[model samples]
Target: MTTTPPPPQVVGPAGAGARTGSGDVAATLRATKKRLTSPWATFAAVVLAVLWTIPTFGLLVTSFRPAADINATGWWTVLTSPNFTLENYQTVMAVDSSQSLLPFIINSVVITIPSVVLPIFLATLAAYSFAWMQFRGRDALFVAVFALQVVPIQVTLIPLLSLYADIGVAGTFWAVWISHTMFGLPLAVFLLHNFMREIPGELIEAARVDGAGHVTVFFRLMLPLLKPALAAFGIYQFLWVWNDLLVALTFAGSSNQVAPMTVALFNLTGTRGSQWFLLSAGAFVSIIVPALVFLSLQRYFVRGLLAGSVKG
Candidate 1:
């Protein structure tokens, strides 16, 4: 009766509970941060980074060293002796020589672009279907496709080659293109499907409710969200196809016109193995494009790899 009993004292556990919860959260976050930045963790990371970088550093040093110097001493000797030259690169890239890698470089680009594009394009469609579409035997079919990744490419080479021959496309760019597409599809589908499944079902349902068809949803909604995943897979496929020796040798070895840089580098070893400088230079040449590609898309690569790792 006296001033409404001072608003009923207005006392409860609500404010105390919130403060306690926030304190716990902050304590947990601080512990996590401290653990991540601990000295042992930093040391381990540094050691691993150095171990991985040494060989590539050696390769770079060897690539620039003169042929005589390369054969006589290790790449590390460059720190004291300090000798370098561009002759190795010159010899490998010289147009007048039969060892010229120019044509093979061009061939690699041709083979790689289509090989990367075809699988990604097809796999995106397949992944979308596997993830969102409700059809009979869908799960069984997805498992079957996933199982193909375990099948060795070596085992399939002969049969695939025979099929290509029967179709009269063997030893042609078409054969290599198709072979790479087939070989790349299984992993591509698996990866993209996992990523697609991570996306909220409500978004797809909302689009459908608004009269957007599969094609519209895929192009307009899914594609933008899928950029990181696509770039990650694209980099992986690009590197694999670019550095591939066995596949190129098997499918495109019949002619220089179709063979990629790996095939050319292989021939360099067979024919000019004694020339250490040429091998080093060719190795660097083969790696440059892939390195650049990886660097350019590295942000996307990391994001793509983290897809489906956590849910909120």
Candidate 2:
């Protein structure tokens, strides 16, 4: 008679577990929101934002102030005795002048574009292979690639320069391009591989069942999901190449035809050490493209950075 009750029937709905999970998630979100909206949190956030913005705002104000005003007082004094001029920017950008930064800007574009593109293209392929393919020594090869990231660029610069010289590309844009691509590869491969591995294995298995080859899966399925990662790495590499002074100085020397804006800006400091107005203007000019690029692609960059941080 006691056994006849046969395990008192569980009366809940089939989705009870799912409902519990959703409830926990909602509670977590609510707690997080509460913490973020607390008065202390709001005050801290405001303080941090103001601290971060002050230096950049000061730099911007200095860029517009006249040379005499810059030399005479701090940028904060502009609140009382505001004076502005475009002469610094004009002189820095003037065409056919010894101090013109326009050509170096063009050279930066040339060096940066290929440096960004080549590493991304190659890293994507390498990451795909490492993530999905089965091959002897694959894990070891990946470890080796990851290890290369720790090797300081300074250590290899001399040897790499010698190699470039032997290959007849030293003192040219090719040398800088190759060096950047080389330095960028290990980090790119590591990040892209981490992102790719986070993708569902079921998708790849389903594609394989549909008779799709590696190339088909990579192009049709993976590429679309990889846009965030690609944009992230592209932005990083672009900024690095664009703002680079050491590589440009090492490989391209002071030749304006091959030197980028950083080298030019550096030389500007050396030659016109007293010209704070011109230096400020050139600094702003150098940062403009990077700021624009970052602002535009920031969403993708955030998503890419969050890759591999969670699991379902």
Candidate 3:
């Protein structure tokens, strides 16, 4: 009353006009920043991509080039000399009716598949029991389990060898598979248990109330959800088993009958001087299976990473 209605402050074109002006300014700034940063990001990405891929590209080129070309000519010459040959691969595989890649790669699969699967199968069961079921000394037991990783591989090598010898599995594929599975169990269980614990507790209880047994719930609900963790572990274990030389050399023979590609590749170089040329091919061959493994399991690997990111 005293102010006689102070101009009845209300929504007006002035207020709307000011807000619209501010919005335009903000949008322009954002667009400008994006435009300015894009080139720098692209440049950095190009540099990184080149650095990351050059060595692998060189290896691929060397594998195709003649040994002399490989030794004398730079891999960069694939751009110029442009000469290509399969002779190096032929030479590496020619002697004694050996494909060089075939038998050793097959042997690696035999050793690695079982080793990776056995540990994962056993670890999943153990992890489920550890995470969901209440039992005696559970926490202490888990700590002890995790602590096993601290034990050096060398520390148990002799004991494991002796055990393998007693079991008559020494120098056999079983020996290496068993050895790898045993060594890999602790970490596998640890990783899986941690992943399982992050699952909502109510889901498990709901399964329980539905009259589903623990085994049923695990196989039905938990296993499907653990896909990511399983994939992550599988890729890691497969690579480990595929590339392992020490365990393979110790437990399996060097005859290439049982030895994996890693051991086979090692023997490719000798007093004839380093067969660095074959190394280029052999390294790529060895990586193929691991790449396939990752590609096949990558979906779950991503899920497993995100599973624990948010709490209920």
Taken over the whole model, the C-alpha lDDT of each candidate is 0.84, 0.83, 0.80
Write one digit per residue (lDDT tens) for candidate 1, span 1-312: 565545423223333344655565666667667878998999999999999999998988899999888999999988888998998899878887876777788899999999999999999999999999999999999999888877778898998888988999888889889988888898889889988999999999999999999999999999999987898888778877888888889889736689998887777778745666877898898899988887888876565444312211
- In the predicted model 3, the residue pairs found to clash are 228-300
Q: Model 3 — TM-score against the truth?
A: 0.80
Task: Please write out the lDDT profile of model 3 over residues 1-312, one tens digit for every residue.
Answer: 566666434433334354665565666667667887898899999999999999888888888888787778788978966988887676555555554566787788889889999999999999999999999999999999877866767777888888989989988899899989988888788889999999999999999999999999999999999987888777677767887888888889787778888888877754277676677777777877777867887775565444322211
- lDDT by residue for model 2 over 1-312, one digit each (tens)? 565666524423433354655565666667667877998988999999999999999988998988888888999998988888898788778987876778888888899999999999999999999999999999999999888877877788788889999999998989989988888898889889988999999999999999999999999999899987888877777777787777888888888879888988788778745677777888899899999988988876565444312210
Candidate whose TM-score is highest: 3
TM-score per candidate, chains pooled: 0.78, 0.79, 0.80
RMSD of 2: 9.1
lDDT of candidate model 3 versus the reference: 0.80
- Look at candidate 1 and tell me the lDDT of residue 151: 79
**Candidate 1: segments with Cα more than 4 A from true spot:** 1-52, 72-74, 302-312
Q: How would the candidate models be sorted by TM-score, starting from the highest?
A: 3, 2, 1
Could you list the CA RMSD of all candidates, in the order they appear? Answer: 9.4, 9.1, 8.1
Determine the backbone clash count of candidate 1: 0
